[model samples]
Target: MNDVKAAVLYAKDDIRVEEMSVPSLEPHEILVKVKATGICGSDLPRVLGDAAHHYPLVLGHEFSGVVEKIGIGVSRVKVGDRVAGVPLKPCFKCHDCASGNFAQCKYYSFIGSRVNGSWAEYVAIPEINALPFDESISFEEAAFVEPSAVALHALQLIQFQGGEHVAILGGGNIGLLTLQWVKILGAREVTVFDIDDERLETARALGADHTINAKNANVDEDWKTITKGKGFAVVLETAGSDVTMRQSFDISANKAKVCFVGTPVRDLTFTPKQFEQLNRKEFTLTGSWMSYSAPFPGNEWELTLHFLKLGRLNFKALIDRTFPLDNINEAFDLYRKPGSVKGKIMMLND
Candidate 1:
C-alpha cells in the first residue's frame, strides 16, 4: 500500500504533514478513509504539551469518514459506508464498564488522546466504535455527533423537569448544542452567557430566551434580573473557567441542580464554607464527564442521524471554517484566538 498523508504533532507548537504507512487492520478492527475531522478543545493541550500525551500523535477525534475495508470479524458494516465513531475504547470487564460507565473504566483509551486519530488520510479503529451515517447527514455534520453526545449526556445528568429554567455559562459549540437539548427536553426558559458579543448574538439566534455579555455586565446580576429574582432551576457550567464555576453557585436557585460539563485546565479550589452554603440551600451538584451507557435510538449513530434527519439539530450553522490537512497549524492558531466562537473548525481531505 502507498503511504498515506497525515498531520502529526510532535511537541508544543510542533506539527507536521508527513507520509505514514496506513495501519494494517487487526481481526476486530476496521479501516476508515477519513473525510472530515473537527478540531476540539482537547486537541490544544495535546499540541501544547500541557496534557499528558504520547508524542508523534495524529490529533483529531471529532470526525466522519468512509469505510475503506473491514477486518475479518467485522459484519456490522461494509466498504463504502459513511460513518462516524466515538473514539473511546474500554475494557468491558472492568468494574466501571460492568456497571455501564465506560468513561470511568480502568483501561480506557481515547482516540487522538491515546491512539492515532483522524488527522490523517486513514485511521484504523475497532469495529465496535464505528457507526453508519444516515444518507441525509453530511460528513461535516456527522463530525459533530461526538460533542453533541457530550451535550446530551450533560442534559441527562441534570434531569431537569419540564418548565424549569436553565442557564448555560457559555455560547460555544457545546453550550449552543446543550441549548437545543434543553429546549427539546421542554425547558420553559434557557439563558446563555458569554464574554463575546458575536457568540451572544449566535445564542440568541439559536433560541436562547436571554443572552448576557458576561465581560461587560455582571453575570449574576443579569441572570438575577432575567429570572426575576427567582434564580435558575438548573445551571450548566460549560465555560470551563474557575470564575464561572464559582458564579454558578451564586446564580442558582435554592435546590437547583448544577452540572459541570467543561474540563478546566487548572485545578480549582473551593472553600468549605461554600459547601456549607450549598448544603444549607439544598443545591444538587454534579459533574458529567462524558457519555457512557445511553444507547443511540436505533444505535448510537442512528440517534444522531435521526435527530439530523428530523431537522431537530443544526450542526451546519455551528461550523465556521474549513482547512486542508496541510494547513492544520493555521487552524489550531485560529482556535486559540480570544473571543473566537466559530464552532468546529474542520480539516477536509482532498
Candidate 2:
C-alpha cells in the first residue's frame, strides 16, 4: 500500500494530519482520491469527545472524489470517474436491507464514524457506495450531497402533503436547507428561529417566510403573534438545545408532527408545563437519524442527488470557505468560532 496523508482524531481537540498506509480495497470496493470534503455539524462533537466506537479515526464523510484504483470484481465504476459516495455500508442480505430500510439494518457500518473516512487523500469504498456525478457538477457541489441528503431525509419522515404552515428551530445549514424544501414541498408559509439573527438572515435569504431571532425575542410570543395563536402544522426541531426542543412542543399546532433532527450534545429536559403542552396538542413526535432509508442506502440519497443534479436544490449559497487538508485544524477552529459565517466550509485534497 502507498502512504497517504489523513487527518486523524486522537481525542477531544486532538486531530493531527500524518502519514498513514493507504486503505486497501476489497474485491467489491473502489479506491477514490478525494477531491473535496466538507465539514459537518456532527463532526464537531466527535472531534471534541462525542466520539464514536473508536478514536484515531479519519473524520470526514461528506466528500466527492475521482476514482484512482479498483479492486477485482468492481464493475460499477472505473478509474477517473468523479463521484460522491454514501458513507452508510449496509449488508444487503440482512432483513432490513432486503426490505429497503437500510437504516434499520442490524448490521450496518458508517464510514468516517465506524471506519476511515474522506479527510485523507484516498479512501476505499464499496462500488455500490460510489456514485458518478454529471460532468457539469463540480466536486465542491458534489461534496454537499451528503448534508443535503440529510436535510431532505428529515422531510421524508413526514412525507409532507403540502399547504402546511411550518416552523423550523435552528437556522443552521440543515435548517436552512429544510426551510427551502418546505417552501418547495408546498408549505403555505415557513417561520424559522435561530439564536443568531445573522443566521436567521441567511435562512430568510433562502426563502423562509419569516425569521425569528429566538435569543432576543420571546419565541412563544413571537410565534403566537405571527401565527395568531394557531401555531405550526409541522415543527422541525433542528437546534438540539433543550430550549428549542421544548419550544417545538410549545409552538406546535394540535395534532402536528414534530421531527427531531438534531443530535443533542447533552440531556434535555422538559418542564411539567412543556409536558402539558404535548398532552394538550397531541403532537406526533419522531426522531430522525441519518438520512438513509431502504433499497440499501435509501431514497434520501437518491432524492438529494436528483434535485442537486437538476439544479433544483441550489446549495451554492451554502458554501462560505475552503481550506486545504493541511489547514483542516484551522477549518475546525472557524467552524467552532462564535458567530462564524453561515455557510459550508470545505477541505480540498490539494
Candidate 3:
C-alpha cells in the first residue's frame, strides 16, 4: 500500500500531518489525485469543540482533482480526466430522491463530514460523486464549485422571482457566491451585510448593489433605506450569527422569503415573536443544507463553469490566500482570526 500524507484532526484544536495508507477502491469507486482543496467555515466547529462528532478525521470537502485509476465498472471517466465532486452520497432509491428532493433523503451521507475527505494526496470516491470538469476550468477555480453549488441551492429554496430584491447577511464566500447567483437569476438588487469593511468592499466588487458594515452602522435602518422602507423580497442569512438571524426578521418584506444557509451553534436562541411575525406577515422561512443527487437542478455549478469559461466570475479576486499541505496548521490559525477575507484557503500538494 502506498503511503499518503494528510492533515488529520484528532480532537479539538488538535491536528497533525501524518502518513496513512492510500484508500483501496471498490468496484464502483475511482482513485483521484487531489490537486486542490478549500477550507470552509463549517470546519471551524469541528476544530473548536463546538460540533458533536468523532475526530482523527480528514476534513476537506471542497476539492478538485485528476482521475488516476478507475475501478471495475467505471466508464464515465478515464485516467487523467480533471473533475470536481459533489461530496453528498444520497440513497437514490429513497422517496425523496425519486421526487427530486435528494437533500431530504432519509439516509444521506457526505464526504469530509461523516466520511474521510480530500485533505489527503489521493481520495477514492464513488463515480457518482464525481462531476466532469470542462477543459476550460482550472483546478483552483473548480474548487469553488462545491461552495457555489451550496449558494445556488439556497437561492433555489427561496424561489425568488425575477427582478425581486435580495439582502444577503454575510460577505463570506457563500454570501458572495449567492450574490452572483442572485444576479444570474435576475434579482433587481443585491445588498450584502458584513462586519468587516474589507469583505463588504469585496462584495461590492462581486456585483452587490449595496453593502452594509454592521459593525459601524445600523443594519435595520440601512436595509430599510436601501429597500425604500418596503424591505427586501428575499433575505438570506449566511453569517450564522445569532444577531444576524435575529435581524433577518427586520429586513424582510411582508410575504418575503427568508433562507437560512448558515449553521449556527445550538446556543443561539430565537424569540417567539419572530415566529409570530413570520406567521402574521406570511413570511416563508426555510433552511438549506448540503448538496445532494444528480443534475442538481437549481444550483449553479453549470452556470458557475459558464461564468468561469467566459471570464465573468472573477474567482481570482475571491482567493484570499493559499497554503502548502505542510502548513495546514497555519492555515487554520489564519481562518480563526477575525477579519479574514472571503474565499478559501487553497491547500496545494507539494
List lDDT for all candidates, in order: 0.83, 0.85, 0.81
User: Candidate 3: worst 10 consecutive residues by lDDT?
Assistant: 291-300
Candidate 2: the clashing residue pairs are: 100-294, 100-295
Give candidate 3's error at residue 296 in angstroms.
5.9
lDDT of 1 by residue, 61-107 (tens): 88889999999989988999998867888888877787777778789
lDDT minimum window of 10 residues, candidate 2: 293-302
Candidate 1 regions exceeding 4 Å error are: 271-275, 294-302
Clashes of each: 1, 2, 0
Summing lDDT over every window of 10 consecutive residues in candidate 1, give the lowest-scoring window: 294-303
Q: Estimate each model's TM-score.
A: 0.95, 0.95, 0.93
Cα deviation at 123, candidate 3, in Å, is: 0.6
lDDT value for candidate 2? Answer: 0.85
Q: In terms of lDDT, which candidate is strongest?
A: 2
- Candidate 2 lDDT tens digits, 2-101: 6999999988888999999989888999999999998888788788566656877998899999999999998889999999988988878887788877
Which is better, 2 or 3, measured by TM-score? 2
How far is 58's C-alpha from truth in model 2 (Å)?
0.7
- Residue 108 lDDT (model 3): 74
Model 3, span 1-350: residue lDDT tens: 57988888888888889998887899989988899898888887887664626677888888999998999999888898898877877777888888878778789777787778888898888987787877788888898888888888787666666688899998888888888888877999999988888888888888899999887656678878899999888999998888888888878899999999988875776679875778777889899886543565334567666777887676667788988888988987776776564567788764
Please give the lDDT score at residue 326 for candidate 2: 95
